[model samples]
Target: MSMLNIPLFFQDTAAVEGDMGMLWMLLSGILVFFMQAGFTLVESGMTRAKNAVNIAMKNFLDICVGSITFWLVGYSLMYGDTSNGWFFWGGFMQGEGADLFFQTMFAATAATIVSGAIAGRTKYTTYIIFSLLMTAVIYPISGGWQWQGDGWLTKLGFIDFAGSSIVHSVGGWAALVAAFMVGPRIGKYVDGKVLPIPGHNQILATLGVFILWLGWFGFNGGSQLAWGGDDATGASTVVLITNLAAAAGGLGALITTWIWYGKPNLAQSLNGALAGLVSITAGCGNMTATGALLAGLIGGVIVVFSIEFIEKKLKIDDAIGAVSVHGVCGAWGTLVIGLWGVDGDTGIGLFNGGGAAQLGSQAIGVLAYAVWAIVLSAIVLGILKATLGLRVTEEEEIKGLDISEHGSIAYPGKRQREFEE
Candidate 1:
């Protein structure tokens, strides 16, 4: 091999690796984007039959608006050099910018989770406005705290590998605020009795869960940020841990609900699986398989009680348990990293002999996100409530959001007035 050929070979090799990374991002981003379909199916299927159209509409619009908004604004805010305040130096023009493509999917996801929690009774225009703001402003600014160069939270050693607290928790907290501001669906609670308003189609919700579970491979795996050489080992290992945690979570929730309610509920089991995924997300890159399994089991159990506590005690009407599954479980996942992180760098689990420093950092990060999301979301929804209103009129709500908001019904024949709100 001549020296001239050696130089050319190395150049070609670098180009090939970069191109492969770009392909990985493109494919993974698409898979993550498909999770929108999963969200739509799950949310629409779990809610009452009459509001299915409204739920599906909100989910679809979230991705459309969120993608455009993130492309326009969110990306810069999230990864830019923070020395310039809100205006960062980085643009989406450098390198492959596969990071931009991938992050856009996540931005949309963070915004869309709110749609499920406040389903059935919100105004359509309000949703559009808030979705835009969430993707463009709220989610991005907070995301910068941990991810962007010169981020304060990053300086503090806060670790969120793939956004358990950053993405899911933020969405959850916002969903809680939106649900509270909008108030419960008509007749959700009457005379201190919590009524059960089951969804129209259970099969659809199950399928949605399956789709989301499948998409998670891309969600967590693609976060490795590379596809060259040794990157494959890390990516594959992360995927394996993700799967193990999910399976553990499913079983944990199934067993708990079965013991408590005398029957294992499928819906809860599905959510348990999701909880496990969320719980392990922050630590997946650093955790042992055993650690991930433990986290998943714990997350599954927490979600059941968390759902009940939010519903029965807090009286927040989260129809899809977004607050519990994502918010509560997200915090659990983020904290678990402090306990299971073992990349020989970031994790300092107290029980694992790393002491309280990592735990403190993790707690601080968690609290910061929780406070930011809750306060900001409450303010946004509050202003909306005071001005154009938050919830629909009782008449509209009872008639159902699909017909009232969209002037159409999801099912043409099943629009019978058999049950009254």
Candidate 2:
């Protein structure tokens, strides 16, 4: 009778554990879904008031379209069986319901990053098409190469605990190519002079950053994919480390801008926090607390310089600095694992007594993603430019996409004069 009781007890425990994990995944996915609101607020706040509604629409449709497409095909391609150790085909919508729900949020996130970079000028229909392709094809294929567990990068020992390179960098690279192909916002650069286009509402942008910081807990923690025993501890630790990095990133930008610009810049400081989050995402599981802080700090400082370089030197108009915050810092975050990564009692980085192997693998992963996102994004944008058109007409753009594209305004009546005058 005692022996029978033991077996029953173990069975009950296993059932409880399974239920807990499912609950965690559902909660985490909800948090990640909330990030769409954060993105919409950030992008809309950082651009002119006239284009605010357009920015919201892009972010909204990213999830709407991304969910249906990913459910139908993207999930199969990402987590499905491999045909050549590079791509996959698992069949349509065949995964566990919880897993599918959680992953759908990530796919949408990667697609929405581009909206902020090319806001104010891009056509609404064209943006929707690009978002669909990104969520369905570009994001899933590359993600499978790592998250699928049997892709080439996984076999190469490439480590991206979350998705610094997989999600953020892919989005960043697409932003870079799209921004370049679409060209700078009108009057942004005239006669080789760089013009400043300030965002309409700093208050909204600030609120958006706070929301994003909160959502990142679920973003990093949910990636653990379990809630039993050590999984709980690991997920909690990742959340704490994620917070430390975000705080360090904000401070790093605050100080850097204070010295470089002779004053603290709120926009740069906000972006710095985001950059830090992107930097630590890849190594959050493998890094020490100290390493996470340093990684975020460096990422914050790097974003300031990178934003200036892209706009001033490259002449690209990335309205919200998405490319620097996500793309460049995402690469930095992935590569930093080679300097301070740990695996149980063993080190996984050169500076920490691992070796050059991990670093080399990281470099290869970074370059591969850059090339993939750039080449594919450019091709898609090029086709759109030739066919349906990418940007709105100059007259339509100046009129504000809210009125021109949606035939309505985000802020009407007396508030219109602030932008018009």
Best-fitting candidate, scored by TM-score: 2
Taking all chains together, the TM-score of candidate 1 against the true structure is 0.93
> Where's the lowest-lDDT run of ten residues in candidate 1?
81-90
lDDT of 2 by residue, 217-254 (tens): 88888887766435313788889889999999999999
Task: State the local distance difference test value for candidate 2.
Answer: 0.89
Provide the lDDT at 15 for model 2. 65
Instruction: Give each model's whole-structure lDDT.
Output: 0.85, 0.89
For candidate 1, lDDT tens digit of each residue in 1-421?
7545676556677766777677877788898999999999999988988898898899889888988888777777776643333443344444436777788889898998899999888999988989998998889989989877578989998988888999999998999899888888877899999998788788999999999998888888787765543432377787888999999999999999999999998889989999999998888777888889999999999999999998899998999889988999999999987776675443478877778888889999999999999998988888888898888888888888888898888878753573224
Clashing residue pairs found in predicted model 1: none
- The clash count for each model shown is 0, 0
